[model samples]
Target: MGIELITLLIVVALLGLMAFGVPLGITTLTVSLVTAILCFGERAGFFIVAANVSEVLHKYELIAVPFFVFMANVLERSGIAKSLFDSMAIAGGRFRGSVGVQTCIVAVLLAAMSGIMGGEIVMLGLIALPQMLRLGYDKKLSIGIICAAGALATLIPPSVVLIVYGLAAQVSITKLFAASAVPGLLLASLYITYILVRVRLRPGMAPIYDIPETGYPFFKRLKFLKGIILPAVLTFTVLGVIYSGIATVTEAAAIGAVGALVVAGVRKEACSSP
Candidate 1:
């Protein structure tokens, strides 16, 4: 068979196996092994697989992937989202449909902190959904806002997706993080604006009820800053270390991972207390 025909047949077989519900990794390996053996014999095929594995293992950048993932998981469990939503809810007060606005803001921050959509969406669903429903928010608007805002995690800095892309494309992860910052913030702003305008146009969709003042002294309200400062500092520390050339991407990721664990430890006692 011609080389082109053989290549096409292998690709078709790979897809057919996948379509038949075979695991993707197994199908890929099977197709590659069959093709390599046909083209260059078993010895060369084995060598090729070994070489690829060695090259991947030798890429030190991949080490950062696990650190970033660890950091994200730690932060996801830290109860930061509830605090963030509470603080932003105060900021959004007195504005029509401000609850939705605050939820979007919380989502933006969660995206930066988590860098993954699944956790952010889950957080929003668990925390914001009940609050929005209690405040008489429209079901459709609440669902739409949570889903759209949570998706920002994929585009924001510290995103695992960006890290993987940078490695695969042989590009700088720091540069990708830097480049995405403006666009991510811009998209988030647009989301908030859309919610505000929609809520204004259809006031019935997101009814505004008077929020009882906490009656606490002004200084007590400052506690709201607590929710924001730590996460913001962590985000800036990781990104700053990278952008300022103070550390490599992997080093920055390590710092972030350590920072996340510290935050989680500190919050654990407080979160568990009544």
Candidate 2:
């Protein structure tokens, strides 16, 4: 068979395997293994696979993956996102769909911190969903906002998707992060704008609701400032170091991971306090 025909068959087999509920990684591996065995001798196929695996393992870029994942998990566990949500809820002002707007803001902040959509979704579902429902937000609008805004994690900085793409394409991860920033923010703006417009046009979808005051002393309200500081430091330390040529991608990832841990620790302590 021609090379194109062989590739087509492999893709078809991959799709079939995935359709059967096989894990995606396993399905891809199986398809590639079969294709290699068919195209080359069994011994050559084994050697080729081994060589590719070694190459992948040896790539320095792969080191960033674990650091990013660690940073994301630590941030998720921290109370930083909740603080941001509270701050944003106040900042959103008293208007129809204000909480929904704040929910999108929370999703953006969580995405910037976590770089994983699932965490944002879970966080919002736990925090924002009940609040929105209690406030009589339209079910469709509430759910849609959570799902759509949470998905921004994929395109933002510290994203695992961009890291993997950089590794596979032999591009600079730092550059990818910098280049993706504008587009990610643009996409987020679009989401926020759409949400606001929708709420405005269909006021029934999101109604104005009471937002309780912090009821804290003037000094205590500074917790909201903490919500913004850590994320700004993280974004700057990670992307800034890379973009400014102060550190390599791996080094930046390391810095970001440590920073995230420190932030999480501080937030944990703060939450533990009265």
Candidate 3:
């Protein structure tokens, strides 16, 4: 009955806190601790808390988040994402609604690279949105492009959200990464198709401006293509290492971190070149 009543209080507290807009992280910590204390005696609860906290602190699966996040931060500030966008946008010259389509494409590609909204949105918002708007795209469509594309954070390989979700759910992060691939493509494809259809139907929504294509010559396009292809290989490398009965999640995470770091380093030098 003591445990039962404490459980009840914990639930009530969580509901009230959420109703009043308390941050979820804090709410979860507080309620979970309180419930543990209620379920076990104080001494037992203390040991359990210490043990669980230690386990979490020592976890290896979570390395993917920070490694990928660092890779993202490094890549974002270095301007690799912009190169990708510029290359694609120039290649798709003069096509109606191509900018919107490009957003989805770049977003997916960037998602695999960085997988963070802050980096993704700021870059896309600054670079792509202006071009789309200048081409007379609807503000709604432009906004949708940025937001929807940026949301690839949830589904893209190296996705930070999925990394976090894997840690919380105690699942193999690589499997989740692999599972998201098909769905991520599907979502991006849907967005692109919608844009093309909408532009075709209204023609007012996304007018094609006189796109001046200086085009990223073959070498440059090939260079930017590395940003897209390397991630795929690294993703498979990490996931392949896991599912092939070789490495554990921790081992795979280490591989991902090393791979992302190496890629970011190479890309950094390229972007820094005159």
Best candidate according to lDDT: 1
Error of 2 at 176 (Å): 1.3
Q: What would the TM-scores of all predictions be?
A: 0.76, 0.82, 0.71
TM-score of 1: 0.76
Candidate with more favorable, higher lDDT: 1 or 3: 1
Compute the lDDT of residue 245 as modeled in candidate 1: 95
Off by over 4 Å in 1: 1-58, 214-220, 269-274
Indicate the worst ten consecutive residues by lDDT in candidate 2: 211-220
The pairs that clash in candidate 2 are none
lDDT tens digits, residues 74-129, model 1?
87677766877887676444667788888887887877766777778988999999
Where is model 1 poorest over a 10-residue stretch in terms of lDDT? 209-218
Go through the candidates in order and give the clash count of each.
0, 0, 0
Ranking by TM-score: 2, 1, 3
Give the total clashing residue pairs for model 3: 0
- Candidate lDDT values, in order: 0.82, 0.80, 0.75
